[model samples]
Target: GRNEKISAEARDAILARGEELGQALAERLPEVEQLLAMPGADQIEVGKKLRGQAQPLIDEHYRTVLRLKPRLAPIKAAVFPLKRNHDQLVATAKEVRRRLQLGSEMRTVYDDTGAIGKLYRRQDEIGTPFCITVDFDTIGQGKDPALAGTVTVRDRDTMAQERVPIAELESYLRDKLRG
Candidate 1:
């Protein structure tokens, strides 16, 4: 499925560019030719020199194209129960994850173990953009009755928390992820 999803033409283009770079380097650098003429010549120094010379090219490519690569994004979002001790919180979190799966093809992870902070860090390490925590407020056990049927949505980058109603969670997430 992964291979089917990847564009063969794009891969070929990348390979072609790499070949061009190698040819250009071999032509411009006399040391490369000398290394080829000699027996058992180490290419490590050549590699380092090439890397040094190609730094600008690599940076430009990453800035203009490679930064947008979707494969870099491992997880779209992670769903978490505030505490594993509570059955209702765990159920709500699972339901939220299920609903997210139904809404989009985005990857979602359900984590229920460890403290909420550690879970958030784990999701962050995986490059998860958002985290939905189903806490007591999600099921009307909070100080504010208005928070019922709402989950605490945390942004991975900013570490900002916002209460989002469960009904609008799917569209809300889709909108945030669109750009």
Candidate 2:
């Protein structure tokens, strides 16, 4: 193989780009260190940055948390069935919640009363980050065969839903809450 040397201009440009990156990192290093230390003031700032959810809740018990991240919420996740009256759905929901509690050791709730919308609102009011629903698809009743043995995870802030395999539910939630 033949060796080629860079032009002086190209070399200088590379050096300048390296310097810029180094300076940017140096300026941000202290901020990163402070966040790692997480003092009261820094924690407050972080809380503010993490609280992206809108709307207001009248419950004073969680009003302070309404300004913080879902990870900071007392109840990290809630499990429910799409239809509370369905016995199989309710049982699966309870087992799923219990498994999450044992697997992650996080605060998890099971709700079988009222509509799914109402259940979500109640969990959101308490600052819960995730709501996992055991729907008909999860129990192999849906047309999609691949959906069996999976649950729907709903994000509290965005209300976005995603299919997650029941076997991986604990780890999936653990990674999400870590942020």
Residue pair clashes in candidate 1 = none
Off by over 4 Å in 1: 1-72
TM-score of 1: 0.60
Total clashing pairs for each candidate: 0, 0
lDDT of 1 by residue, 1-179 (tens): 11333355544444444446577663444433433333222223433444566654543332321122223466777899988989898888999999998778878889987888778767766677888999888989988888999998998666799999999998888778875
Candidate 1: C-alpha RMSD after superposition = 15.6
Query: Which tens-of-lDDT digit does each residue in 67-177 have in candidate 2?
Result: 348677888899999998888998999999999898876999998788887787788777889999999999999989899999999988777999999999999998998
* Model 1: per-residue Cα lDDT at residue 81: 92
What is the TM-score of each predicted model, taking all chains together?
A: 0.60, 0.62
Q: Model 2, residue 7: what's the lDDT? A: 45
